[model samples]
Target: MGQLPTDVPWDVNWDKKFESQLEELKQSGSFDTYRKKTIRIIRNPIREGSYKSENLKGLKTAHVSGNYQDIICFELTPGVNHQSQQEKLEEVYLHFIDHWDNYDSALSSRNAAGRTVEFTIEMPYLEEGYDVERAKNTVYKAVKDLDGSRITQEWGDECLRLTGEVSPEDKDVVKTAIPTTVDVKFNENTLF
Candidate 1:
């Protein structure tokens, strides 16, 4: 299913509208700077702000720990409601694409050689019966359609990589089977 919005205006008041909400985000000392930077980057550029179920499941965080390095975190909240688990994940998948690089940089660092790098992308989920294969494909589609020019100057492409693995025990929610047939034998001659 297509989880994004339809007929969204490309030009809208993204900043003035969400300013108050963003200010409240600063309470989290860990996310203060990153959140501010994201606002500046997304306000004017991403004119259309819509939610997909992917956004719900798309809740993600990136962390980096090393000498002389402070950890940072980033999350994608599309603000969309998906009625079903699969739909929620799809919404999150789409939302994550909007800020992939921000998440990556927060979790990355430069080595002695001066090349920037991140250890890994950390994404956790609260839903059971989640589909890894489906999620991977969904993310792939999201990043491939990323809009670079619309984002703030601070963001980049590194966060687009879906490099995490699923825990082995993860399972898809069990669904009840539908009745396929009714047992019946007709004895026409014995109908006397």
Candidate 2:
């Protein structure tokens, strides 16, 4: 998926009529201050304006910076109806990339540094047995999306478990997406 207009940093496109006004600000040097303020807001929006005190979880905020004709604006609203868990998760993933440095999406209760996710799938319902290997790969992909690394994968029949100290994120997404993405009846063993 690509940017959905709801993504962060924002897009600012000034009107053609304002070219002269913009130039005037540049000539007067006041534009430099506005420009820096705009840039700062774009770079780390959550740490700016109203959001300076809060963190994120696919939740976004807005700001209208600068004055009169020189005004620049931004607003973000989550999708009208994220029909699928993946779509909701993809949105979260976008934010996940934005605040990767400042936030932790996955925090294991077992330890400060480790995250654990486990799932088991039973395929006896299918006349043709399901691919256990695909299930393994699915677990790996989910773990990777969680930012999991140095993982310890233990596979049994149709089950997979992961645990390690790799500072990952997206645990909330994992809860819904993993089971749905794998398209299997899943029994979640654990998640962090």
Candidate 3:
């Protein structure tokens, strides 16, 4: 488990994939009320509408605003050792933001197009003092060894995202390439 900083306002950040989705929402003008509401989620996490996610332990989801069509998924870390009496979290990591209706579809992508499938490896951003440099070096080394694979890591505020394509044969290689300490997720439909 990783600990979060005790900084005020709880540093909030998102990954590239989430940013891409957010950009689409911004362009379509659907996120007008989302920005302010997100601040609320970061400031106060255990509010009425927010719910502890069943599948993703330690994470939660809450609507951006009242009856809003957008949803925000984030992980909130509490202050160290319950030293403070207040209920404020030390950090808020934005995992994703999407139209409420697209969740079902987002979880339903077809089999990953092996030989050309793009992979994104995500690892939570831990508080400083963690071996971040060594971890990065390990990933870089593995990426270098990948033959014909074009994987790149894009670090995010919430999670480190490594996005790139791998061939069918190299797909399995990817599984072994990244360390088991890293957490990787694909659409629900993806088997590998």
Q: Which candidate gets the maximum lDDT versus the true structure?
A: 3
C-alpha TM-score for every candidate: 0.17, 0.23, 0.32
Better of 2 and 3 by TM-score: 3
Segments of candidate 2 deviating more than 4 angstroms: 1-130, 148-150, 157-169, 177-192
- Give the residue spans of candidate 3 off by over 4 A: 1-114, 127-130, 186-192
Weakest ten-residue segment in model 3 by summed lDDT: 106-115
For candidate 1, the lDDT comes to 0.25
Write the candidate numbers in order of decreasing TM-score: 3, 2, 1
What TM-score does candidate 2 reach?
Answer: 0.23
Total backbone collisions for each predicted model: 14, 0, 1
Q: What value of lDDT does candidate 2 attain over all alpha carbons?
A: 0.32
Candidate lDDT scores, in order, read: 0.25, 0.32, 0.44
Q: Write candidate 1's Cα lDDT for 147-181 as tens digits.
A: 21011111123322233211112111000110112
* lDDT at position 68, candidate 2: 11
In model 3, the clashing pairs are 115-168
